[model samples]
Target: MTFYDVTVPISNAMITWPSDPAVSITGTSLISRGDFCNLSELKIGSHCGTHIDAPSHFLENGRTIDQLALENLIGEATVFEFKNKENIDVSDIKQLRFDNVKRVLFKTVNSSYWKFSTFKKDFVYLTKDAAQYLVDKGIRLVGVDYLSVEKFESQLAETHHTLLRNDVIILEGLDLSNVERGRYELIALPLKIKDGDGSPARVVLKST
Candidate 1:
């Protein structure tokens, strides 16, 4: 009955992808200032910390966040740990068995980047070939421990395209540093934004 809350906390200080809007929070109303109730305003990108990338994130005619099926967001998942790998490539993908696995989360060295004060440009990510392998194997959802599933500054964004074009859900910015490699039930619920390409999500894992 144990649960793992793998979502990273959102804050103005949290590491964000370069060029993306930084998180901003301000107290619009405060009891200390004689306001009846405390109210805060938040300004954040749709692709902020701990989020899901809808197919529309890359595909021109793909489904938006609200249109995504809940069946794909909540289900059995497997967390796999990779050690000493710069990126998850075809060779690394070949070592695993996907027999009945629909959702997979990769816990890599990137998880340690969460402890740093800044974003690590060299964080571990998924290569295009590895992404294609997963799609070929019929993976419904893919999760990673960084802001992006693809290599930073990738010009083509091939990894993202490979998965998104096939309707595979991409979950990113996960704090998998404390979670062990094993099977669990994944519950990732994103804000139901209309025509949204991406949205931050509250992700949790329950022991199966």
Candidate 2:
């Protein structure tokens, strides 16, 4: 059996969504600095790096990150490779075989942009119609390789609302460069932050 860690590394210099705060890690004590042990204060957005978005992220009175169940976060998942697409449209999504696939992760050109130091304004994202398509097919979870699942600067943000409103778990900022298109056991769990709209997650895939 082999395992793949699909989570991106989070650091103080990592690029973040323009609307979100930057990652910050400050040390209060360090063994190298004559302290008893190393202690650091961490400050970062709930959505930093590989994270899961609760419905509360885009919906009012929606479930929080703590409410996400382990069953939904860990299970069979399929990786879909999308190439030469500016954005994932309903037409493209309609062709996906949704049978018996509970979780879907898209590996797109956006994964290449992960090597950069700046946030990309044109990362591949899902269209509102495509988002609805997943909901229509009873998709329980959706994952993307970029910071957001929706298009950048979308006027309506329909992509996010449509999925979140329907209780679809949104996993974002994944590093799927090492994985191939196929079925695997997904293990992704976010921190149990009370009332958190989102939380950092460590996502991995295993083949048995």
Candidate 3:
């Protein structure tokens, strides 16, 4: 019963998405301040660090974070690896071996970017066509090793729209650097934010 904690640690030092609010942490109370207990203040974007994007993130009148079922958040998942990919295209998606797989996590080279302070502009991401492929394949949940599943340069964010419109759950900002490409039991539960479009999550994997 070995478990892999695949979530990236959320901290003020962590790289954040451009234009999003920077993570901040400060001590509100400390022993040095003559306080009996230590207290801290925290502020972060809803989608910071490891997170889940709900359908409402892109689709209008779509379901929110609290509305998501636990069954979709926890399940048997396939971890697939891709090397030397600038962006995940339809061809890459077509190569996946599916056997009643409802959840899939892509371990890409983008995970290496986690070590840098600067946000990577060229992170490996899913193309709209590849997103469509997943929708067609009936994937209930899709995860990525980077901050977003869609390309950074995408103005329209068609990839996000395609998946969200199809009711596909998107898990992003995963740190898969330690996890190998194989089958694992996924236990990713997001913060229960009411009517939230997205929220941070604690994602873990159990080896079978």
Best by lDDT: 1
Q: For residues 136-203, could you state the per-residue lDDT of candidate 3 as single tens digits?
A: 88899999999999988689999999999888999999999999999999999999999999999999
Q: Give one digit per residue, the lDDT tens place, for model 1 in 103-198.
A: 999999988898898879998989999999999999999999999998888999999999999999999999998899999999999999999999
| Candidate 2 residue lDDT tens string, 58-127 | 8889999999878889999999999999999999998889889989999998888889999999999999
205: Cα error in model 3, Å = 0.4
The total of clashing pairs for model 2 equals 0
Model 1, residue 27: C-alpha shift (Å): 0.8
Q: What's the distance in Å from true for residue 157, model 3?
A: 0.8
Model 1: per-residue Cα lDDT at residue 47: 97
TM-scores vs. true structure, each candidate = 0.98, 0.98, 0.97
**Model 1 stretches with alpha carbons more than 4 Å out:** none
Instruction: Please give the range of 10 consecutive residues that has the lowest summed lDDT in model 1.
Output: 110-119
lDDT, model 2, position 126: 93
- The lDDT per prediction is 0.95, 0.93, 0.93
